[model samples]
Target: MSSSWPYPRWIAHRGAGKFAPENTLAAFRLGAAHGYRMFECDAKLSADGVLFLMHDTTLERTTSGRGTGGDQPWHALSLLDAGSWHSRAYAGEPLASLGNLARYCLRNGYFLNIEIKPTPGLEAQTGTAVAHAAARLWEGAAVPPLLTSFQPEALEAAQAAQPQLPRGLLLDSLWKGWLETGLTLDCTALVCNHALWDSSSVLQAKSAGFRCLSYTVNDEWAVQRLLDLGTDGIITDRIDLFAPGS
Candidate 1:
């Protein structure tokens, strides 16, 4: 792994994961209040191609709206109650756009990791759009947001669209040609499930010119193991439990 990693060691997942509404601005604020400087969020396109923050393909789980999120235009999607599903405290929280998130992060001088979560068949298109939008949004910034995705096609499209922005390959398993794929895409980091990283996996990723990172690591043992393994970054849901910069 390179020694010049610029992001924080701890990143709040989906803006705070279970603490607030996943991928909503409220969750991001909660994560920030807990002292997290870096955050991870899922980005996908609306029917009209507006980039927005959301985790699921369907809105039923996290919002009051029904049907596929990508099937709806931004005007309609923006009106959905994204936070009420979590709790009444965050009721009426509108869906957050990529522009809104960019403004918030830039104002706070924070870092971001945006996962290119495309709706089913729109992976390549969504990836391209997100990359272009992010390039414009973060122009002239010192640290560009790290673009990551489990889909190679999405990452490939993002790379083709914005070569300057850093990218990472997210893996839940050590699939065939995983390392070769990361190398092919010119990924800056290899973000894997926390359990996937051992001494061997760490060495393999680091030796192949990619920083090692873990996702959704919440337990004390998982955090300690990654630290002991000398990983570069950790994405976690327990923002309240793990203090950033400690």
Candidate 2:
């Protein structure tokens, strides 16, 4: 990392964390309302190659549709009630396309962290398309969305597609060769699982030239620990409990 991180210290996870339906425009709006200037969401490509916000490969958990979400074209995917599963308050909220999200963020001057959640074998394609779309969407802007993924191949493809956009390696574990992989991918940041970041791990990542970030950090103690370790960012689901910029 260049020690020149531009993102905020607090990021609202999946929009407003667990407060609203995750990865929806409604969630993002709620996140913004709670004073979050930066929001994180998942992005995947539909069958027709349209980029949209969705976290799972299958739609049963979060949307009204069944089977793989990527199996459907954008026209069909757009009609699903993505919010009904969450609660009646959010019933009938359509799945939001990346284009819709980009416009919303750009218009409001908010930052984004887009996790490229590709379907089972389309990692490279999704990464390439997302990078190209992000390049076009945030062109000439002061800051670009931080593209991140657990799949190194996807990040590599994204780098090959649009090297101008910053990339991060998401780690659920500090697996063997993790550091080398992040370096090879030209990552600007290393986003690790919350439980993995100790002082030693933070030092290791910082020494290798990468900003440290954690995900789904909710409790105040954990937040305090991360801050004490001097990490660059905290991705949290507690938008109500942990006010942004605090």
Per-model CA lDDT versus the true structure:
0.93, 0.94
Query: 236 in model 1: Cα distance from truth in Å?
Result: 0.7
What is the clash count of model 1? 0
Every model: Cα RMSD to truth? 1.1, 0.9
TM-scores for every candidate against the unseen true structure: 0.98, 0.98
Residues 1-246, model 1: lDDT tens digits:
235679999999999969999888888999999999999999999999899999999999999999999999999999999988899999999999999999999999999999999999998999899999999999999999999999999999999999888999999999999999999999999999999999999999989989999988999989999999999999999987898993
User: Lowest lDDT 10-mer window, candidate 1?
Assistant: 1-10
> TM-score of predicted model 1?
0.98
Local error of candidate 1 at 211, Å?
A: 0.7
* lDDT for each residue of candidate 2 in 3-54, tens digit (9 for 90 to 100): 6788888999999898888999999999999999999999999999999999
Q: Model 2: clashing residue pairs? A: 1-209, 1-210
Residue 207 lDDT, candidate 2, scale 0-100? 91
